[model samples]
Target: MAHPSFSLSRRLRLSLVSLSLLACGAAWAQQAPSSATAPAPTPSGHMLAEIQVIPRPAGTADDRYKHVDAAIAVIQASGLRYEVHGLGTVVEGPPEKVWPLLQAVHQATLEAGAERTLSIIKVSSGAQAGGPRVEDLVRKFRN
Candidate 1:
């Protein structure tokens, strides 16, 4: 017979794992294309997205900047126009290109030894009434 505490801990772990899988499924659904063919580009032929990929290593307090820089390297090599902000990175490009690039960023962090990764993303269509541009958004309030 197992201890009650051990059984409870195991159940909690299972619940957490199930929730994580569900979250991943939801993220994939959001990024997935609606049709088999490529998506139509906006009038400006581009879109803007702000993505923050946070990787939490399981143990110890150590330097995580290396993981961040690794992910940034992947972004830099993608050839898309991007701005690295203090909190997140803003990338502008067609949806076909940007979505894969974001996936690459998350993968890079995991390959760099992140136990688990979380990506927070915001996307805006260029056809929207007031779309975002890195320059306009960043420079508007500058001195």
Candidate 2:
């Protein structure tokens, strides 16, 4: 049951459900009944993630961009496989390195003088062994 104080309109509920299905499709979505194959064992700590850092520094658009750049610089220096997309930067590595790298990237924005910041991230890992790779998902799309 939903919280009585937090009810969503029917239309909004449907939209949220749709979005949830898309977000979880690879990991948790229901699959068609099949007997030929079984799911892989639990994932390793390897990950592929997209991180979006929004720095709200007291400054003009260019200044805000500079803060974002600061965060990207941290990403660039980490030496992880990464690609800067329009909304976020995608990074791939083992969890040990990626976790610290995420913290450093978030802190970079504040260190660059952002009053406050918001970071959004989406992380996924392969079902089998080995670290996830950005190329695994986007290589075909790239061409």
- Give RMSD to native, each candidate: 11.6, 8.6
Q: Which pairs of residues clash in candidate 1, taking residues 3 or more apart in a chain or in different chains? A: none
User: lDDT of each model, Cα atoms only?
Assistant: 0.63, 0.65
What is the C-alpha lDDT profile of model 1 across 27-65, one tens digit per residue?
A: 444553447644434335567777776665422247536
Residue 18 lDDT in candidate 2: 13
Displacement of residue 24 (Cα, Å) in model 2 is 12
Q: What is the TM-score of each candidate against the true structure?
A: 0.61, 0.64
Model 1 off-target regions past 4 Å? 1-43, 58-63, 127-131
Find the 10 residues in a row with the least total lDDT in model 2.
Answer: 13-22
lDDT of 1: 0.63
Best by TM-score: 2
Which segments of model 2 are wrong by more than 4 Å? 1-45, 58-64, 126-128
Scored against the true structure, residue 112 in model 2 reaches a CA lDDT of 88
